[model samples]
Target: MSGNVLSIADRQPEDVQRRAVAAVSLQRWREIEHARVVKKGGVPVQTDQGSDLPASLDAWYRSQPVKPGRISPRLTLTDDEKRAYGLPKSARLIALRGLGDEVDHWSVAVFPVMGGYVVGVKAPAGGGGVGVFWRLSHKASDYARRLSVEHGMLIRERYA
Candidate 1:
């Protein structure tokens, strides 16, 4: 692994969380929030609009096109987000919730078919479909686990 990645391995937990949040594209994170809302049947929750984000996430969102005619923008997840969401050993299927913006801001909610925190939700600035959300290539769960552990370690180190 690269030295930078190894450095991330030693970061504090909060730093890892911050980096994890920053690593994902703005649209992907929005989709996660949107999916969360759908799973809750359009329930209300605090939304993370692009305006409130740090430079890393906010800067990227500024360059992307807003989905069609939607007022709020959406963020999509990278393969890494899939890895995090896919970690629940007992999770059979992960369901993607569309979007819920009725009460406040827009967000997506995802829930396991069996039920649990395996689901992740993200909010978008403009109303739109999950933007550029991509699934990870097929691989053994062991491989996924390894990646998760490596990622977790890297995150811990980066924040340390």
Candidate 2:
């Protein structure tokens, strides 16, 4: 296969996350937010939506579409899309969710940046990408673990 056929999957997950982070520019850095924890059905805990952001990025993100349902059980990627967007083609789109609940109210958008793609995630609670929203509803243990212990939602063992 040609070099162009090479994808981000070949790299480690941490490397892919790091490289994508590194590709962000000082100016664009101002565009995204961080440490924004939000309630399942409420606004973000905090953010800088008023902070100056690129018009293109702003418009682009605003115009992007959303898919509330979970795309996959795992952070799966559209192989061709990852390459087209300058992400590690091998790495899946990283989405952390306790379960697929309310996924239909969220969207995973891709914004082109200095060196790589900024994986823009939009949840119904708030509207932003990347570090903008830390959704508690979709947190890892919120679904699987909590249900398993509280409601007896678990896999029972069976002899072969």
| Per-model TM against the reference | 0.19, 0.20
Prediction 2 global C-alpha lDDT: 0.37
lDDT of each: 0.38, 0.37
Error of 1 at 116 (Å): 19
Candidate 2, which ten residues in sequence have the lowest lDDT sum? 128-137
Residue 40 lDDT (model 1): 75
Q: For residues 13-44, write the lDDT of model 1, one tens digit per residue.
A: 88787777787777797789778877877764
Q: For model 1, what is the error of residue 74's alpha carbon versus the real structure, in angstroms, after optimal superposition?
A: 13
Please state the error at residue 55 of candidate 2 in Å: 16
